[model samples]
Target: MTHRTLFLTGAAIALVATAGLGFGLGRLTDKTPAAAEGHAEEADHEENFIALSVADAAKAGVLTTTVGRGGGSELVLPGRVALAVNALAALGAPVSGAVERVHVAVGDHVSAGAAIASLRGAEGANARASVDVAAAGARAAAAAAARDRRLFEAGVVARQDWEASQAAADKAQAELRAARAQVTAQGTPSAGGLATLRAPIAGIITRVDVRVGAFLTQGGLVAEIADQSAVEYVFDAPPASVGAIKVGDEVLVQRPDGGEDSARIVAVAPSAVDAGAAVVRAKPTAPAPRIGSIVSARVILAKGAGGLTVPADAVQTLEGRAVVFVVEPKGFRATPVITGRAAEGAVEILKGLNGGETIAGKGAFRLKAELGKGEAGHED
Candidate 1:
């Protein structure tokens, strides 16, 4: 064979060897199932992510996100239901007397001018008799005065005599008026035979301090009538809390019978009661509060003005500044923010953040610790 033919034959031989090697390599690469299984095991190791257990999270007081509305803060106050002072009536005797009869009993509803009790007094009878005598004298004097005036007009009587008669009649009339005023002032029935103790205002009889034949002093209370037409809640709170409460602020009244009523703060005592507790007065809705009933008061302190706010737990204290942890794609970041009035569980966000930002609702302390640990590790 010539030299060129020998080289061509060598090249063909090398090509056949290369084909054999390629075929062996292809067979070795054909075990795809085993390689895939190995790769899956390796991924499983990397998938072992860490997370907190349910019990642990609960123990840490971890909470989830919830949408909060306006009106953020309220201060709870303890109070008791009371009768409006104006609605209370103390059935007292205008003169010293013995209770002849109790016209009404406890829990009875009475109207204005309705009799609740009757009193018999010595002064009362004397007052009636004096008024009657004065009225009779007044009629006689009036007739005499009219005759004297006619005589003076006709020039048949001396001017001094007519004037004297007029003066006498005037004096008698004044005496009669005085006697009638005395009777009225004694609470005697006006033109009626019985001196009945009538209700000054319409309401329920909450107390009966007198029975038949009970002796009472002048102006002494005999029964207590409560006009439950309007009820009030009386509260004694600390002076520190007084600044947050004001008239016309909304109040929540909680009853022991599992009932709730709404009211407005109508009054606040100018000074403290017992020099320790401040007096607060509120007027509840209709269906008046039972006298002396106990209730709870929730006075609003701060209200939201339709701004961004978050739960207090979401805020973290860092380096003496109010900080909140915001979870980002990379990790959590401590963000300083300005806050406004806080109510209940929410606080107003005045600055440093806008609404719709996802913040760490809970478990932010753990992230903070992790960051601290990372910093220590780097220092080491």
Candidate 2:
């Protein structure tokens, strides 16, 4: 073959190959639409399939709500029950004496002016003897004064003599009065030579420091009596809670026996202990368990006027801020929230959420993971 004919054949073969490739590409482009339609149908069927993966379903978890209440905050403090000073009585001996006999034992309830013990001592005995002697002297002075007065009135005695007699009688009467008071103070008259230690107040004898035959001083304590009808609970609270706790605020006393009692804040200490802790006192209406008994108290700092609140765990940290996930039709969304004081395992959401929004109550962390997965799948 000639060189020109060879070149032309080669060129023709190249052109045929190019044409065949273009035809094959065009056919491929035409079939692609049908293939794409099949894919679209499969996707439509998948969209109807509501089956969520185990992980995705787990991410949904349970739902819960939060509410806002009118309470400031609650401060729980450990405390102990004590006798109100006004209700406590300390029985003391008016004179030095040996306790001849104890009429009351510990835990014995008594009334005001009730005899708790009898004291036999030299001072009490001397006071009784002086009272007897003064009584006789007073009688003699009275008779003499009366005779003098009659004589002066009858003009048988001088005015000066009658006046002097009157003065002497007045002195004698004063002496007798002093002696009687001393005898009475020792709790003895002629009733017996011994002085009886009377209860200073109406209450139960919580403590007995004296027994029969125990010698006690004039100012020595005989017994401690406390009214068992009412008690006081004293607790120390943080200084931050000072303003929150008010006089007459409700208090709850937790007994060690698994029972609860109610009380009201009677006094809030003006000063703070440990710089940041204030002493709060409450009066319990229930029977006084015992003096110096340990108890727990819950002081209500605020009350419920009721708005919205959510579980504390439901709020999570996102981008260095507090947030909660609200399930939206599109997916789970992170909602920023303004949180308030948390109490009772829940937190107050001051803002960012309205009531009736479904929140992931159980597994919020799992929801975050599923959301990340959905985003990744979209990118793919």
Question: For residues 308-345, what per-residue lDDT tens digits would candidate 1 score against the true structure?
Answer: 67887777776666777664453346777756557787
Write out the backbone clash pairs for model 1: 72-343, 73-343
Q: Candidate 1: global Cα-lDDT? A: 0.73
The residue-by-residue lDDT of candidate 2 on 1-380, one tens digit each, is 69999999999999999999999998878767789999776544221122244346554664444343445445577888876758888878888878888898998989999988888888877888887888888888888888998999999999898888888888888999999888887887343558888887788888988888788988898889988665688887755556657999888788888788998998887554457568899987776456678888776654666535777777877656677876656445667776656778787665677766766555666655654555556567
lDDT of each: 0.73, 0.74
Where is model 2 more than 4 Å wrong at Cα?
1-69, 72-74, 156-167, 189-192, 211-214, 255-260, 271-276, 288-294, 301-341, 344-380
**How well does candidate 2 score on lDDT at residue 68?**
36
TM-score of candidate 1 versus the correct structure, residues matched by position: 0.58
Summed backbone clashes in each candidate are 2, 10
- Superposition error at 92 for model 2 (Å): 3.5
lDDT agreement of model 2 with the native: 0.74
- Which predicted model would earn the best TM-score? 1
Which residue pairs clash in candidate 2?
66-308, 66-309, 66-310, 67-308, 67-309, 68-307, 68-308, 70-305, 71-303, 72-302
